[model samples]
Target: MSRLLLLSGGLDSTAIAAMTRPDQCLTIDYGQVAAQAEARAAKQVATLLGIHWSMITVPAREVGAGLMTGTATDPQGPPDAAPEWWPFRNQLLITLAAAWGVTRGITVVEVGTVASDGARHLDGTSLFLEAIDHVVASQEGHIRVRAPAAKLGAVELLTTSPVTEDVLAWTHSCHRANLPCGACPGCTKRRETLAAVGLLQ
Candidate 1:
C-alpha cells in the first residue's frame, strides 16, 4: 500500500518522512510568510529521500487569523508561551491531505506533528488524530491518519531516524524563510533542540 506524507521541510516532518518511507510526499503552499522557505526545504528533502512529491496551492490571499496566513501573529517572532498558535492548522492540513489521499487511492496519510506541538497546536494532539481518523474512515475509503512522531521529542526523533548532519542542513524550521532570523521562537527552539542532541554547531 502506498502512503502519503505531509512534509513542511522542517525537522519534524522531514524525520517522519524518512521513517515512514512513504511512496509519495505532499505539501501545500498557502502564501504564508514561510512559503518560500518551505518550498526550498521541501524540494531539498524530496531529493534526498528520492520520493515522488507534489505541491498544492491553497487559495488564501489575505492573512487569516493564523501563523500560516501571516496575519494573526508574526511568523518570525519567537514562539511565545502559547506561540501565537495557528488556529485549526492541523485540522485543515489533515483534512486536505485526506482529501488528496482519496483521489490518489492512498490508504494512509501521515503527519510530522509531535507531542511538543500540543502545547500550542490543538490539532497536533492525539485526540485530534483520532478525530481525523474517524473522519477519514467515514468515507469508507479505509484511509488512516498516522503520526509516528506523536510521542517523540526532537532529540528522540533525530536518533531514531537516519537523518544526518547533511540532511539536517537542508531543513527549514525558520518561520521566516528568506533568512533564519534565529531570534524567532521557532529558530530558537530548533537550535536548542539540535544543541541538546549535539547536532548543532
Candidate 2:
C-alpha cells in the first residue's frame, strides 16, 4: 500500500522518516508553542531525506493543553497520565493524515510514537492506534496507523536506521521553547536517547 509518514520533527520521527523514506512526510502544526521550530525541523529532515514535505495547520492554541499552549510540562506532584498531553491529538492527526492520504491514494499512515510514549500520553500507544485504525478501516482501503517504534525506545529504534549523529541533531523536541529548554521531558528524553545510543557524552 502507498504510505505517508507523520513527521513530528522529533528524534524518533526524524529517524523513522530518514530510515523509511516515505513518499511524503506530513507535519501538523496545532499551534503549539514551538510550531515554527517544529515545522522548520520537520522540513529540514524531509528535505535531507529527499522526501516531499507537507503541513497541516489547524491552529489548536485554544485547545488549552500545556504542551500546545506553553504552560508547565509535567505539572506538580505525581506524574499524571495526561501530563503534556494534548486532547485527542494523535487521533486528530491520524484522521487528518488518513484523509489526506486517501486523496493521494495512500493507505498506510505511520507515526513516530515510541514505547515510552504511552507512559505520558494515551494516543501514543499501539492499542490506541489499533483502535483508531479499526475505525479508519471501516471506511475502506484499510488505511492503518503504524508506529515502527511502538515497541522500542529511541536508541533501539535508531540502531538500525541510517540516521547518524548529524541527522539526529536536526530534531526539535522542546515543548515550550523554540530552542530546546533542556529541562522539559522532551529534551531530557532526547539527551537520554542520544546518550543511550553512544552519540552523546
Candidate 3:
C-alpha cells in the first residue's frame, strides 16, 4: 500500500521517516512560529533519505494558541496544559494530511507520536490514534493513520532507527523560533534526546 509520513522535522518524526522510508513525506505549515525552519529541515531530511517531500500551508494561526503561535501560553487552555500545546493540533494535522493523502492515493498516513507525548497531550496517545484511524478509514479513501513510533521514546526511536547524526543535524525542534532557543520545551527535549543517544556532546 502507498504510505505518506507527516514529517515535522523533529527528532521523532525524522527518525521515523529514516526508518520507514515512506513513499512520500508531507510537512505542514499551519502558521506555527517555526514553520519555516521546520519546512526547511523536513525538506533536507526527505532529500537525504531519497523520499519525495511536499509542504502545504493551511494558515491556522487564527485558531492556534500557546508557544507554537508565538504566545506565552494559552489562557483558555486547561490548567495542566503543556506550554506548547495547541488545541486539536494533532487532529487538525491528521485531517489535513489525510485530505492531501486521499487524492494522492496514499493508503496509510504515519505520524511520529512517541510514548512520552501521551503524558503531555491526549492526542498523542494510542487511543487517540486508534480513534482517528477508525474515523479516517471509515471515510472515502479508507486511509489509515498509524504511529509506528508510538510505543517508543525519542531516544529509543533514534537508537532503533537507521537515522544517523548527519540526518539528525537537520532536525529543528525549536517551537519558539527558527533557530534553537535552547530554553523552550521543544529545544530542551531535542537536546536531551540527542544526548541520550550520544549524538550531542
Candidate 4:
C-alpha cells in the first residue's frame, strides 16, 4: 500500500520523510506565510529520496490565527506553547491527506509531530493523533494516521534520522517568512537543536 507523508520541509517532517522514505509525499499550502519555502524544500527532499512529490494548494488565509498566517492571535499561551499555533492546522492537514489518499488508495498518513511539538501545540499530542486515527479508520478506506517520530524531539531526531545533515542544510523553519527570520520559534528551535546535536557551530 502506498503511504503518504506530510512534508513541511522543516527539520522534523523532513527527517521523517527521509527516514521512512514514503512512496509519495504531500506538501500543503494552506495559505501559510511560508508555503513557498516549505514546498520548495519538500520538493527537494522528495527528489533526493526518490519519492513522488505533490502539492495541494487550498487557500486558508482568511481563517488566519497565527504568525505563520501573518495574523495576530493570543500571544499568551502555555509556557511550552509557541506563538505560531494555527487553529486546527494539524487536523486540516490530515484530512486533506486522507482525502488525497482516497483517490490514490494510500492507506497510511504519516506526520512528524515530535514529543516536544505536542508541548507546543495541543494538536501535536498523541491523544489527538489517536483520535484522528479513529476518525480515519471509521472512514471508508483502510486509512490510518501514524507518527513514527512522535516520541523524539529535535535533538533526538538528529541523532536518529538518516538525513539529519541534509535536513539541517535544506529545511526551512521560519514562521515569519520563507527566508529564515532567525527570530521566530521555528528558527530558534532549529538553531538551538542543531547546535545541541553538534551539527551547528
Candidate 3: worst-modelled 10 consecutive residues by lDDT: 71-80
Return the top candidate by TM-score: 3
Each candidate structure's TM-score, on Cα atoms with residue i matched to residue i, is 0.89, 0.92, 0.98, 0.94
- lDDT tens readout by residue for model 1, 136-158: 77885778888989999877898
Give the TM-score comparing model 3 with the true structure, all chains together. 0.98
True-structure RMSD, every candidate: 3.0, 2.2, 0.9, 2.0
Better of 2 and 3 by lDDT: 3
Q: Write the per-residue lDDT of candidate 2 for residues 1-201, one digit (tens) a residue.
A: 777999989999998987778888999887888888999999988888889999988876676476557875554323564556677778888888998888888888989988888877878777897898899888967787788778887788889788877776788988877888887778888889888888889
RMSD of 1: 3.0
Alpha-carbon runs more than 4 Å astray in model 4: 73-81
Pull out the clashing pairs in model 2. none
Candidate 3 residue 198 Cα shift, in angstroms, is: 1.0
Clashes of each: 2, 0, 0, 0
Clashing pairs in 3: none
